[model samples]
Every structure is written in structure tokens, then in C-alpha cells.
Target: MIGKLNHVAIAVPDLEAACITYRDALGASLSQRQELPEHGVTVVFIDLGNTKVELLEPLGENSPIAQFLERNPTGGMHHICYEVPDIRSARDRLLAEGARVLGDGEPKIGAHGKPVLFLHPKDFCGTLVELEEV
Candidate 1:
């Protein structure tokens, strides 16, 4: 039901700075930066060869990223995204297996403009797992 890891999303206070830090300090390269107004956050993608890292910055106080940062100020891993061939089928299987779906009975436009859905963290051993069809 799951394919290769698409990327690891991490919450951060500053997107550009994080990109620079990861670039020079950790040798990660900035692949793209996109603002997701609907989600009230901006995401910067840092390429790491086969995998990628997504840096998320809240655009507003009420944004979920803000709440995430409040819980872990020194922002860290936010979620794990897995590339799925068919989101609906994958979601159905997960639901049949008792995993809680965050989406409301339908997939939504997600980062990279792809259909995406999230499986509740509690269902995945406290790790937020996102399934995306690219």
C-alpha cells in the first residue's frame, strides 16, 4: 500500500534560514519553496538525493504549524509522506485496518499539487503519515 518515502516534513520558524542552514551546514539543497495559503503555511523543499525534506513555516498564528511549533518549539519532524499509486485504494485499506483518516471522505489538493490524505498519528504509532499520489 505504501511506496517510496516522498519526503519528511519538518516544522520550522524560518524557512529561508532553515534552507541555508541545511544547505551549508548539512549540505541539503533547496529544491523549491511554495506558499500554501489554504493551509496557512509555506513549505520549502530540500532535496536529499533519493529522498527530500520539507520545511514548514506557519503563515498565521492559528495555523496548525503554529500549534505544532508550540508543542515542539525547536521544530522537528512533522510528518512522513509516502508516495502511493492510488490514494483512494490506499486510504480504503488503511480505513479497513482501522487507521483514522484525517480527510473528510475525500482526498484534497496537497503539497506539490497532488491528491493527498493523512492517516491519524495515533493509528501509526504516534507518527503522522501522509499518503500522496504524485
Candidate 2:
């Protein structure tokens, strides 16, 4: 099943502004910006002692984030990630429970370089959920 809360991902129209807000205004420590081409996002992570906050910007026109931004011009919370001991097992359990997995129904490398899978937002009360293997 699900484990600890991994991180909350927020889509931002402007990555630099979002970084400044979190780094300067909120005084948070942020990781260097990293481009995840496979995920079609450029991301920066803010360290939060117990968890992290991920700020994501669309990397290309076809980026899923781009589609999200089109629907929500201002950008907002995109998804919440949770850790799992075994991603495949977790995926199977979710499937058995009638939860839909996004994409090819396989785990992909995530921001933390760990295996991750996204569940359909509609299946989780309109909130996108990500399962990351720990």
C-alpha cells in the first residue's frame, strides 16, 4: 500500500518566480533546477524537513503540465506523491481495487530517481496521486 507522504508537486507558469518565492520569501532551501525530459518538466525541489515540495514547469508544448496550465492558467497543485515499499505490488493492489493507473501502467523514474507511477485523478477524489517506491 502507500507509505509516507513523498512530496507535493505544484505546476508553475514561471519557474524562476516560483523559485524566488519559495527560496527568498519563504526562506526554503531549494535544489538546483533539473530538466526531466521524459516527464516533460523542469523541476526544482524545496527541502521541508519531513517532506519536499516540487515546483514543476512545462518543458515542451506537448508536456502534460502544459495541458494542465492551459486548463488552469495560473497553475496550481498538480499532484501529491506517496512512498511505497514496492511499486509493482502497490500498482497491482490498486488495479485490483479498480483504480486506474495513468500512462502505460508501469513505474517510471521520478524526480528523486525512484520508480513512480501516477494514478488517475478521478479515482482519487479529483486529486492526482503519485506512488513512489522507497
Which numbered prediction scores highest in lDDT against the true structure?
2
Stretches > 4 Å off in candidate 2: none
lDDT of 1: 0.87
TM-score of 1: 0.93
Candidate 1, residues 1-134, lDDT tens digits: the string is: 78999999999988888888998898877877888888888988887889988899998657877888989987989999999999999988888988799959589888778999988999898999988997
C-alpha local distance difference test of each model = 0.87, 0.92
Q: Number of clashing residue pairs in every model?
A: 0, 0
**Residue 32 error for model 1, in Å?**
4.5
Q: Summarize candidate 2's per-residue lDDT along 1-134 as a digit string, tens digits.
A: 67899999999999999999998899999999999888889999988999999999999668878888989888899999999999999999999999999999989888778999999999999999999999
Question: What TM-score fits each model?
Answer: 0.93, 0.94
Q: In candidate 2, list every pair of residues with a backbone clash.
A: none
